[model samples]
Target: MLLPTLTLLTCFLLIVTLLPISNHTHWLIRGLDFPRLQIAIAAILLLIFQLIVLEITRPSSLLLICVSGFCLFWQSWWIVPYTPLFPREVKRAEKNSQKPSLKILTANVLTPNRNSQALISLVKQHKPDVLVTLESDQWWQNQLSVLEDDMPYTIKCPLDNLYGMHVYSRLPLTETETCYLVEDGVPSMHASVRLSDRVRVRVHFLHPSPPSPTENPESQERDAELIVVAKSIADSAQPIVVTGDLNDVAWSETTRLFRKISGLLDPRIGRGMFNTFHADYPFIRWPLDHLFHSEHFTVKSIKRMPSIGSDHFPLLTTLVFSPKAIPENEGIDASAEDRSRADEIVEKENVSKSEIPQPTAHAK
Candidate 1:
């Protein structure tokens, strides 16, 4: 009984460590930002393996442990594709007194979550120039209507499905386009708003469901959509900001690639990775929400707001636009070779016959 109880305790510890691994996998499969989750899982796995070896001694139980270890090791491969190990520093851009400006906020209010009051409180407190919400239903739409007086400019598409999205802006919206980047009905909101100085800034709000048996066959579509957006931003000369519950993490390979491809900067690097999802489970959380920007803006501050009933914690960021030129090496500069390699990877991943890449032997 002592040995059995010890084994059970060991197994429980291993399982607890593995649960975050599963959550990280779920986030990655969904094309969401969740690198912190991946890192936590990696740390936990390291500790678990050490404990397993120290505690298990019986042959039958050891064999069972070994098998479980093998499966756990196998699962690490899913995380291998997304890990962002490179350290990136944030360098504040020189402020220019001449430029017009804009401020934005993005959140994913989990539709079933009844924390409408908490969410409302957050909105009232922050008072961002623009507010975008995903997973909004009619009820949420109604609940959020109180903000119409302040955020008079708005575009709402609330639905019963969690995918219902909305955008409200304080700036004058010159044009707005609702685009379907991947699956039908999964819309991405795009708008051009005139800032206080009459400068136009392009803002895009996206929330694509990751690859899952129920939501998608694979993550290829989600990845491709992100890549497409990256390509568009790369081509644009305008100051652009992309914000939403990206369902991806700041440090993931895909996000890094997206930043490189789109010439965008992340506020998290040099600051901190603000883990936003699974608000109820502080020990097992990751940053699945994000705001990526072009070089025209410098982040003043960014933070994770208090839990507002949803599985995700709302993210608030304040950025000041600066016409200051980015130092040659400080900004994203994907060379021709890099772009070619990235394009090939994207193409391969999007191919219908392709299988998700397996974890390397070293990763295991």
Candidate 2:
């Protein structure tokens, strides 16, 4: 009993202390493979294990206090190492003078969240060149239709359920397709658009379900879908940008691998995490929403917008394609080594199309 209790306590301590460790170590996070949903389940399992094996006692209480103290100390130092510093090698792209900038706004408008007016107000304020919304239902879609006139190019799949995703762009959409990256009905939008300069860029908008007992019990589908997109980006010749809720954080292992695999750069790393999930809660937050860009582009700016009605705060990023060289220290170098590592990780975890489990009706 005492052993199990100590073991459970140790597990909790490790989870809390090592949580920050995940931000820096890509392999640890990706290979472990379970989504954030598993973290909650692991917590429950620890509690049950402790209750069944050990009797609560003064010593256990003291041990927990010590563990708490350790967690605090660990957290204080853990954050320092993972803090993103602007890479010293960032340089002005020589091509910035020639190419027009692309500004994008992405938001997860929670289904049943009826603050479309606030969202509209935000869009009016930002006036981004492109807008993408997740978890948008028919009602929400109708409300957003006002933008169709100004934002002539649009692709919408507004489901009553949370899987609904939409994209509205000011640029001419040359090619567009709605794809099911993982399960049936879980749609992701892909498109090629001609910017004002006539430069063609491919964009993929994704919103994979977070791992949960209600949704997927495993992270296989989410991880696989992400890998597929990453590989596509790697293979794509056109300048590419990916944006959406992602339902994962910038610091997570999967995201890092995706960045490396796709050779996409995240402006948020040295700038700030800009945690977007659980918008109402200030403390228990993570950067679940994101924007990733190919090396051809340089970030003009990125920000987290004020909340409308969803659990997630919106994200806005402006990128300009520049032919100039980037500094080596600005972030990560998408070197051959990094790319090779990323490819290996993706190939090793490449689950076949037949293997992905279908989402149950209840799961939706």
Candidate 3:
């Protein structure tokens, strides 16, 4: 009876595990992508118990154990990149180099979170060169406006739909625009920031809609929106940075594709998960807030800041641009097959509307 129960549990996890490996972007399959770490841990515990506690296993049970171990190993392969045991996707900045750096603090304020003081305090402490906030309404805007004196380059879209976004940068900004790429109300920020020595770093900030029962029933729009952004930035020559709550886990296939298509590296790789969401429930958290940069940049530091009365924690990252370090880091080379998959994903939905306006002539 115990063996049967164990088998049933293993089978259930395996079903959830294998479902996400498919190319389909339905919410049911895509939702399982978030808990791969938890599932992997469970698999490891089950395998250890079966090996040590169970004895004289039947041939059928033996096969089940083998499958359990296989699943555990598979899950670990995806997670190992995000652990210190594996090498980082982006190299750390060398102390001797005098490369100019940019510090950014990106947070999702949950729209309804009224405690703007906490977020303001964190911003004051960090003193980031750029600030990106998602799900922010007019009240959040009013509260956050205190920092405008320091960061005058601004792009604001305050909406009540919980998809509002705002970006403020201390550095000079050009060609700044808020684009509604996927849904009618959803907005993303695109601009270029001029750093020291007149270097221009192209920036893209997105808060893609998540696949959920209340907000969005399907993951198709989210996946398509990400693919569109990835494809657009694939061939850009300037140093690029993309940040925001992607609403997708780092290990998901779509995210992996995004990394390949954009040729951007994740600082969280080979470090820690830096789980930022569900801050109220410690156990149910995942790294939803993300920052991905082009090959020209290397990490100075990346940290998860303390909660500011919101369900999500702000991510603070400092990066230094280094074109010479590209050869030392790892990059994913997308194949013809990968391009075909991306094309198919983009074609599935008719995403043809943008409310983005031309940048002010002086800002440009």
Candidate 4:
């Protein structure tokens, strides 16, 4: 009885592990892309159990073992890049480097959660150069007003919908725009941040809706929104940083394609999966919040902040704009196939191709 039960369970796990490889946009299929880490762990433990408890004397048992091994390998292939075993995609900044550094604090302040002061305290302690809050409604905007004096440059879009977003930056900003890329209610922020007198960086903040029955029925809008952003910054010559709650894992096909198309590198590669969502459930968490940057920048420090009474624990990252380090770190380039795939994804959705006017930048 035990052997038959184990075989059935292992086969089911294999099916779930392989489902995300399909390009289908159904919420169920796309949703599987978020839990590769947990699946891999389960697969390995099952393999160990079978090896010690169940003797592989029969041919069917041998085949099951082989299939289980393959399932584990497939999941690991997608998730191993974020572990320390893989090579670092973004180089670490030298302690003596004199490059200009920018610190950014990004959080998704669950719109319904009324814990405004908790988030404000994190801002005070970290003192980031930029602050990005998603799922922020008018109430959240009013509550976060105290940060304006410290972070003068601002772009605010306080909507009742969960898609609301705000950007507060200490540095000077130019060419700033609040764009609605896919859905009218959903918004994204684009701006050129003046890091120093001689250096400027292009930054994008995004919080696309996820593939869920409650929010979005399919992942089309989320995938297209990301591709649209990727196409916009693919050929940028200046330093670039894209950060926010992407609502997708770093290893998902959509996100990997976004990296190739935009030529941006993920700092989490080889460091760790800085899982920030579901702050209350430690075991069920995955990396839904992300920060990706150009090769011209090197990581100074990156960490997940403590919970602030929201579903996502904030992410704080410090990156140094070191143009000299460009030769050492190369951005992921899109192949002809990748470019074709991205174009197809965008073509399927009726995306807002036009750029919007700059929002009123609030000042103290």
Candidate 5:
């Protein structure tokens, strides 16, 4: 009974592990992209059990071992880059380096979780130069207004629809715009943040909807919005930083393509996974919040902040402006085929004029 049960479980795991390879936009398949780590761990345990219990000389035992081994390898290929086992994609800041630095703190806030003071206390402790809050409604805006005296520059988009976003910064902001690229009621921010007299960086804050039964049945809108942003960044010559709860894992196919097309570097690569979601569940967690930037910057520090009454733990990252380091820190680049894939993704979404949201009012 035990052998048959173990064999059945191993087969099921193998099937689920291969599902994310499909390009289908259905939530069931796309959602599988989030748990590659969990699946990989399960595969490891199954492989060990098979070796100890199963007769190695039997043909059935050999086949199971081969298939399980293949599944482990595939999952590791995607996850290993985010572990310390791989080389750091974004180099760390020098101990005595005195360069222009910018600190950003982003949290999802869960919309319904009302413990605003928890997040407020975290802000006071870290004092990030820029603070990004998602799922923030009118109530959250009021509660966070106390932070305005220090973070004077502000952009607010309060909505009850659970996609509202706000940006508060101590540094000056210019050429700021609120955008709804793929769907109305869902907003993203674009701005030029002045880090120093000689240094200014293009920053984008995005909180795209996730692929799920309650939120979105398909991943088309999420993937299209990301591709649109990547194509625009590819044409720019300025230093950049893009951050938010992208709702997709760093190792997912769409995000990999995004990095390739935009030529941006992920700080989490080679540092750690820094899993941020499912804060309430210890066993089920993955890195959902992210910060991706241009090679003009190097990582000073990156960490997952303590919970603030949200499903996602806040992500705090400090980056130093170091354009001279670009040559050493090469970003992921796209091939002609990759560009074609990005174009196809954008074209398939077919966003209509009516879907475009009107300009939202801001607190300035």
Candidate 6:
């Protein structure tokens, strides 16, 4: 009974594992991309039980063994970058460079989670140069306003909807704009942050919509919003860092496309998962928040912080501007086909207002 049950479970998991291989934008298909880590764990456990404990050497068992092994390898390959076994994507910041560094702290406060003390404590503990919070409402804004004294430069859009966002920075922020990138209610921030007289960096803070039954039924708009930002920027000269709760996993095809199109490198790659969502659930969580940067910078440190009474945890990343290190990191650029697909997403003619959002980028 146990052996037959195990085989059936293995087959079912395989189907879910392979479904996202196709470029389907449906919520169900895209949603499957989030659990690659969990799925890989399940496959490993099944393989161990079959070979070591169960030891059922029948022809059917042999087929299950092959399938289970393939699934494990496939998932691992997708997530290998997050493990130390893989080489770091962005080189570490060198000590002697002594370049100016910026520490950014981003957290999705889950809106209704009234406990601002945890987030406040984290900000005080880390003393980040920049602080960003998502799913924040007017109340949250009022609660966190205490940070204004130190982090004077601020950009805020506090809506009742789940997409409201706020950004606070200690450095001088110029040409800051609050934009409705794809959805009317969804807002994102773009600005130039001046680190010093000789050094300034372009920063984009985004909290794009996710594919879910209650929200977007498909991933089209979400994909389009990210592509718009990626396609608009030039990576070679200007130093750029994109951070926030992207509402998508780092390993998803859309995010990979964003990296290729924008020529940005993920610091989290070759680091760790830094899973930041579903803070209450141990078995179910994903790296929904992200920080991606151009080759002009090197990572000092990137980590996931402790919980703050919200459904999501905080992410802290410190980067030093070091254009010389650019050559050490391999750049990922979009192929001709990748550009075409990105064009289709951003400029699809048949898209509805709700599904296709015109990305607004400006300086004020």
- The lDDT values for all models are 0.67, 0.68, 0.85, 0.87, 0.88, 0.86
Query: In model 6, which residue pairs have backbone atoms overlapping below 3 Å?
Result: 81-270
Badly placed stretches (over 4 Å) of model 6 are: 53-57, 234-236, 349-364
lDDT of candidate 2 over 110-174, digit per residue (tens) = 99899999888988999999999999989988999999888989998989769999898888776
Q: Residues 310-347, candidate 3, lDDT per residue (tens digit)?
A: 89999999998788888987878888888888877777
Instruction: State TM-scores per candidate.
Output: 0.73, 0.74, 0.95, 0.95, 0.95, 0.93
- Count steric clashes of candidate 5: 0
Judge candidate 3 against the unseen true structure and give its global Cα lDDT, from 0 to 1.
0.85
lDDT of 2: 0.68
Candidate with better TM-score, 2 vs 4: 4
RMSD of each candidate relative to the true structure: 8.9, 9.1, 2.7, 3.1, 3.7, 3.4
Worst ten in a row by lDDT for model 2: 355-364
Model 2: CA > 4 A from native = 1-11, 15-98, 326-364
Q: Against the hidden true structure, what lDDT does model 1 obtain?
A: 0.67
What's the C-alpha lDDT at position 89 in model 5?
95
Q: What 10-residue stretch in candidate 5 is worst by lDDT?
A: 355-364
Candidate 4 accuracy as TM-score: 0.95
What clash pairs does model 3 have? Answer: none
